[model samples]
Target: MKKIVRLISAVICFFQLNVQAEEPKEYTFAINSAVTPLLHAAFINETIKTVERSVAPAKLKVLYVELPELERLIENHQTDFFISTAATIRRYQDLGARDVLTASSPFSKNPNRSEGSLFIVKEGRSDINSISDLKDKRAAAGRPTAFGMYLAAMGEIAADGYDPKTFFKSTQFYGLNRDQIIKDVLDGKADVGILRACYLEDAVNRKVVTTDQLKFINLKNDPEHICLHSTRLYPNWSFGSNPSVPPAVLSAVAAGLIAQKPVGIGLYWSVASDFTAIDNLLKSLQLGSYQRFSKEWFWQRIIEYRFWVLGTLAAFALLLIHSFIVSRTVNIRTQELKESLKRESQSFHEAQEAHRRLMKMQRAAVVGQISSLIAHELNQPLAGIKLYARTLQRAKDSGTLTEDKLGTALAEIRTDADLAAAIVERVRSYAKGARSERVSSEVSELVNKAVREFKRQSGERVEVKLTQAQPVHVIVNPLEFELVIINLLRNAAQALQELGVSNPKVDLTIRRSDNSAMITIEDNGHIEKETIAKLSEPTNSTKADGLGLGLQIVRSIIENHGGKISFSQATSGGLRVEIRLPVQEETK
Candidate 1:
């Protein structure tokens, strides 16, 4: 039985070798700094697992290169797969590298495509509270070319009141690898070290550094991820493949990376990496990481730095010239403004007096025009009172009055007196010329009330139509709104009566928009163009015996309520007046 088992194993190994020969004979992958050591280890492990599943021993080669070298390798077809920061992926694509998969660290997983730089130190070290404390102390950073590592550290060093170069007794680039720099800091080879955020995970797992020994210093807690990080974070590395490779190979590689533990990197796959911000950073740094800076700009900067002192002096001289020109222009304008102000101040008092006189005249004009209507309005309830009294006397004389009949008579008497009091109150208020008391009131109610009052007073032959988009509640003076509507309707009714139109019509409409309310009152009458023009003009009455004061009063009331009024010809041969008022914002 043992011999048979050994033979079967031997047969399986031979077939696997034969199958591996049939598969793609060769393939290579690239690794860089942003990819953690664990990811690298996992990728190799998963690759082996994938080969086993496929029943083949396909030989896979791995190449570890710094970010810049990786770019050259992919473009040259020296590697089949490349891993880089998202920014680098765009740079590589522009440089002829194909993007396949985006790699993520388990520590900084989904939704966060890139990690920032972290400044770690021994926990109990009091000598270094911040980057500034690193003065005269040795500092180590992972790869000067690795933007996240050094750029972030430099910014912190500057912010902590220390120049990155002058702040340290000695600063050195600790190889283009994170693990090496982490070890250097842990082994006491460096006083300060900057590492990518996720690199600490590996050091902790490997027992190379403990949380207590390595402390993250000057940690920034930022919203918008702009934490007061001792160092800024650049975009995370991307898992990509070389486009020069066959599509089949790219598919297999992408599939392998995406599959769970496909080769040995943890469960990580392609995700969208927005590197626009990082690109902006790289453009500022002028790093040759990409063609973001053209050769012309690079040479121009090189020349400028050579003569920076002279250039700065020249720029200062031009600034002074601009300042002198602006100062002269401002002085000239100031004098002209002073002269204009003197002339305007002489007319301010005159303007105020004229405004007061005009308001008084307007009030008198409205009172005259509505005198008959006001008398009629009051006469209605008084006449009802007289009729009710006569009926009550007749009933009492006929000996038909009972307790219920007397109660009814008293209630009718009270209603007639109340009606008379309201008409007097409205007239008195209008004559007082006091500003309308504004509050939130339903527009439809105000319009309907005005129509009812007009019909009661005039009893003119007219058709009234009221339409509202919705029950519009506006911040307004109830009295003022009612007054305006009444004036508009009365004007419309008068125009119809004058035209001798028996079936005259008045239409009231209210429209509500996002920020304002519009009220329109339209009438069907054969009004001449001259009459329409004179409607709103003060003292320009179109009626032979009319005061021409109704519309003017309406305009005043609406304007006082923070509104505007205008008149236009309706499409069906009539006058249309529209009033717009701002809707006060609702209190939360």
Candidate 2:
């Protein structure tokens, strides 16, 4: 009896092991050929990564299937899940396959249905002006069944008065690979080649073919061609889960695919794809048939007569109300326009008078600000002349008829006089009311020159620093840019003088980064927080001496150069002013 019991227990254990082995532990999925990029991104990378993170590294088999193979997989119940176009999913649903998730295509980001096909030829080839011209030309296509190559091309050809069966002399179809077709065209193996519309941009950007090597022809002008398109955009792809898939697994797959992101494609997720257009195309060509939805009629009746009638009536009412409102607005606008015309002439004259007075005030203020500097500049030459004259008198008094030495002394005197004349000339140049000169200048050189000139005139007490030493180049009106620097320096000098700082210093710094140039001036003047707040607020200077138009003019000049200025307190207890200027990219 004990032996018999042991035998039964062993048999029971063997049966239990068989049951566990037979349980389903693997799943299979197929990628629709149209959505290969998305397949690689989501399933191959993201889905497996997600499963690895949660469950142990169980090998998941993924199969790629074309449309026909996908249909067969469903018929034989070989696939656990599948991804396909919206129309195909609808057809499967009609044939009793339930949708678990909706699939989206790569081109679904752009809502405007713009798309088109291309007909390209080799460099300088002008024999073909239209698709009808391909009657006897050899053409190569990336994919014969591709929406762009076959459907879009056929639609264009039919419009151009040609039938696909007899239009071209010969046609060669390759699976979806553009590199092969491009190579074939470049080698003169094919008279014509076809590509998706925007596909050429990527090729040109990557230097696959020089722009001169390719010529595009026969673009359709439909609304669908006006927006994101290449060779007549067909509907996008659809993703769906298997009907036998558990809800939890279906939800997980949808979440995983939506979360997948690999570069180039921006924030992506599945959206409802409108395949009615593709369905219509297929029906027209009798390439495939779609079964009608059973509840489609119920929804169709509610929309056809009920929703559309109400919408039409509502739109008509809105149009009438809009017209009435517009008529009333037009009458009011006419009266307002007459009143505006009466005021325009008076306003123009007043504006001109104001502008004239403002210009006079500006000139007076600028002259006043530089009065001391101009006097100092003049005094240098006068002082030199005085010294030379004294020397000549001494030489004459002690001379033993030294004519050669006296002549040398006279030449020295003449040199000092010429130096005075040069100062006068510089003043004249500044005083003259002429347009500034425009020139191309290296940025580092300009900043260095400006700082040296400031230091030479203003004395050694002012410390200048050019923190950023990168060389930037620009085309600018030199006089205008120089004037801007001078004005800023003058303001900084005045700020230091007002604070009565002994080591009165102004620092000039230059910087270049990315696509811009920056010049900064820091002065050892303790500007109050309150004062700094009101600096750019158009407040006049608190000084009792002259008008505070220096900062205002500096702002205008920098703005004209496409630069901006900002003020802040320096860490070393002074005022800091930064000017940022944009660097223009040179075109080759």
Candidate 3:
């Protein structure tokens, strides 16, 4: 019975070994969808055949997934071996995968390396002649997660100072396929297209797109590679195994991939190449293994270098304090400047006020001087009126006066009284200052009135000759203007009287020149050059009893009325005064 039992055990153990041998080792192989479906299927078939030959009874389960899924599978330790680009392979390495081999193609100049992306546009598209022209243009690319074609294209664009996210107006990604991108560009649906390097060469060879229909953008001349590329080259796609995968399986898969012979497309695997260039590409783009630092990672780094972080914080605080101090200093200076300006403005206004007060006092003094002259002029008129009154009273008391004589004496008294009243009125007008009512007065009339008044006052001591072409009119205060002419005539009469010339004469001429009324008063009396030079100066006198304010007042009044006055030696050996006043238009 013991022998029979042992025989049963041995047969059962033999059957168990057979079952174990036939069950097959299941190995999940994950591949990123970096190529078209047809090529991916061929790659899968080739990979399966190579791995199955090296490790017998190995049932390789091929899983084609996008880059995200490939990464997930790697992180979850769900895949045994993965075939993907170097960028994705580096990500797998971070997830505890070991790179075993790299891919090589007949199209690659270096069998162990990969090439960059190709930027293409339609031929004759002059607006899109270069990579920089991609701004705001419609572009088509492969899958966004793709490394060789899409990420590589992003790196190239970023290197050229373009942000791939916003550089193009619109970007559409076709999953793991360049045919749609090429078609879109050709059909005018897209302005530019990006594909993995050597894609265009292969497409042209396959007759998918004609070389004449497309143009390479940012083409680099690499005689060694002899292929169109826009970015720097990186290591090719790699075959790698998960760290959880059995060492025996990893060894077998590595040997199988390296020994796999080139078949269709002359593609095969090579020994794993240095992925540092691929790492740099991903780092520059902040993609794959070198993705942007997460918040958790940032805090972790901060905790790792706490002393340096504290030092940076201290420096930042010091800089902030410095900025505050500078701001405070600037504000204090600005306030001080504002206060200084305020004080300067106050001082300027005080000076202006003082100057105005001084001008008022000077004007008052001039009016006082004119008052004294008026008082002196009134004294003779008053004395003559009193003398006439006394004579008339004496004549009436005598009772021997004839009717004609009595009438003549009364007339003389009336005339003397009228002259005294006129002198008082002149004094009142002069004392009233420069404010006078203005009206349109004829220059000829003003000149005749001034001459008649001068003759009445001086008893025709000087001959006055008046000449007028036409009736020239001017806007002026009649009283003030008449005062101006009277003062000039009075000065001329005095000058002639003092000279004692036999034929003392004053010639006054009035005419119109353009928009001005010209009045020329020429005297034949002798006047010194020094007297003429200072003729219009205030308080300057040619005569011992002269106030010297007459000519000065005349010039001031003429200038106040927008006229000019000038004194020159007359051709008649006397002083000549020219007054120009603006003429007023006559109304019909």
Candidate 4:
């Protein structure tokens, strides 16, 4: 009886083992081929084989589908589970798929932050050296929805405070031919190629992306990592299933994935990690399910919160009506108060204008008294200097003045003061029977010196771009000419800052416009042409504390140096101040 029972148990065990292996429940697994290359898809298919199907070890029926058509499959519930990028998985989750496992590696302790973007540029492309340099550059990438291929790189730009949609000159998308983006960059069809992190390493190993012509940009430190990347790491590829899939099967799949050995680049499946990074990335880019709020979505939200929304709106209506009644009651009285204030303002302005005229007269009288000992030509600027000094004293006393206004006013005083001192020194030298000191300098070289002086004097608030320059030489007193350039650059920068130009750019160009060397100072400010035309006219200034004699003094210096100063409307919508000085006879 014992022998019979043992034999029966052995027979049962063998049959059970045979039944488990022979009758495996097959599950359908989906892969988005548009975003996943052939080799990657194959690797993912191998991973699916490790998943278990409850009592019987599960087998996966791999289904390849385009990214755009994945939605159709999810809607029809054709695939039980799917393997895709975290970004795409989120999109599937919105369509009723739940994440089961996430791909991981030994590279990072936090397996979720294993995926990132790699920015590629041709080795010869020096123009695109960094992320910010990608502005107006043509970009090429894989599917629009792929995070590593597109959104990851664009997020870097958005984080830099630029609108990613319009940051690039243009963008092109290549569907399944993802590697073609790399080729596009090398062949000069695209300025940058956005690819997945470790893609270059894997491609080179597989002999896909060939040649040393490609270079990685914005490469972050990858200590103990397999490859270079441009952006911060995000969650890796995710494995998920349809909502209708049985929990037992999902648990088995998760167990199999976590148990599987590491694959390419040490990649293997691990327990599901936080996908909040992916969701946040989508939200930031306004892509995927987080796309810009649409009319339908808004209406859907309203419907969902109809009662609360109605209550809030009713309260808002009551407040608005009350406000309307209050505004009506106070409208006439407010208008009368406004009229009175306007009258007072007009009277105050009239008195201020009269006071300004009186001060001007007083300044002229003081300078005329001092002119007995100085030259007549120097008297006007000397009077302006004294006037500015008195104004500075008054501003200091009032304690309501700003540094910018003070700096600007003081700069004028300094420039004019230096000019007056130089003129007096020259006169003394003439009295001693000596000639004025001057030198011949290359325009490019001298202009550089002038720019340095301008930055030093005006501080670094303004950027001076010497766009183009020629080797032409000119005879000039370096002190006076540089001072003149500094004054003009300061004026241009001030106008741009005051007008709130996005980027205050003062482009300085030096070349032979005609028989003389022309130095053009143009800015991207919004000052009027009418204002620019009268900038050099005496007593016609734009600054509140200005004596309107700065440009007049500039004109005097240029004229004494045998040069002509002129102004015009710049193509950049700002003032264009041009100075033509005689070229040094020998160097020409």
In angstroms, give how far residue 241 of model 4 lies from its true place.
Answer: 1.4
Clashing pairs in 3: none
Which candidate ranks first by lDDT, i.e. highest?
A: 3
lDDT of 2 by residue, 1-588 (tens): 546544543454344334435553466667667555423354444544543322212234678766568777775667766666544554555445544444333444442242346777787777877666678788888555555545566656655556665666777777666766777888888887777555665677677887678766665455433222324455444455556554445454555445544334442335544555555555544343332323544566667799787898999999999999998999887997878877998899999999999987876665554443445444544665677678778877777437787687677667657645654554465456444455667776777666765554455466666666766776666545654676577667777876788887777777776777787888877877777776776436645553355566567557757788888899877888888888756779
**Which candidate's TM-score is highest?**
3
Models, CA RMSD each: 12.6, 20.0, 27.1, 28.0
Worst 10 residues of 3 by lDDT: 8-17
Ten residues in a row with the worst lDDT in model 2? 50-59
lDDT of 3 by residue, 516-573 (tens): 9999999987777887888766668776766556666666678879999998899978
lDDT of 4: 0.72
Off-target runs (Cα >4 Å) in candidate 1 are 1-141, 144-173, 176-353, 367-373, 386-588
Per-residue lDDT of model 4, residues 1-588, tens digit only: 546544543454345436556666667777777534322544565675554333245455777788767756765788887767777767656667777777766555566777888889888777778888888998898767677788888788787888887888988999767778888998999999898887777678777776587877898886645567888777777777898666555554555555566676466667655777777777778765665265555788899999999999999999999999999989966998989999999999999999999976855643433232245336545776887788888988999678987998898788768767875775465345443478887778777887875664456477788955558888887766765786787677777887888878888988886679999999888767678767867547677756334666577668868999998988867888899999877735
Better of 2 and 3 by lDDT: 3
Query: CA shift at 296, candidate 1, in angstroms?
Result: 23
Candidate 4: segments with Cα more than 4 A from true spot? 1-26, 34-43, 52-60, 106-109, 206-212, 263-266, 292-588
In candidate 2, which residue ranges exceed 4 Å CA deviation? 1-25, 32-44, 47-59, 64-77, 83-108, 111-116, 158-161, 220-230, 241-248, 259-264, 290-588
State the lDDT of candidate 1 residue by residue for 1-588, as single tens digits.
546544544555465556556764666767664454635766645644543333335556667777668767866778766666655565556556655555554444442335567887766777878666667887788666565567656655555555554667776686655566767777778887877655676667788666776777778654444222455555455666665555444544444445533334344555554665555555554444444467866777767786786788889999999999999999887997888888788688788889899988978876665564455445655776787788889999999888898898788778768766765676667689855457888788888887886775566778999889987778887755765786678778877887888679988888997777888888888766776777768666676655355566667667877788988899878999998988767789
Note the Cα lDDT for every prediction shown. 0.66, 0.61, 0.74, 0.72
Error of 2 at 301 (Å): 37
lDDT of 1: 0.66
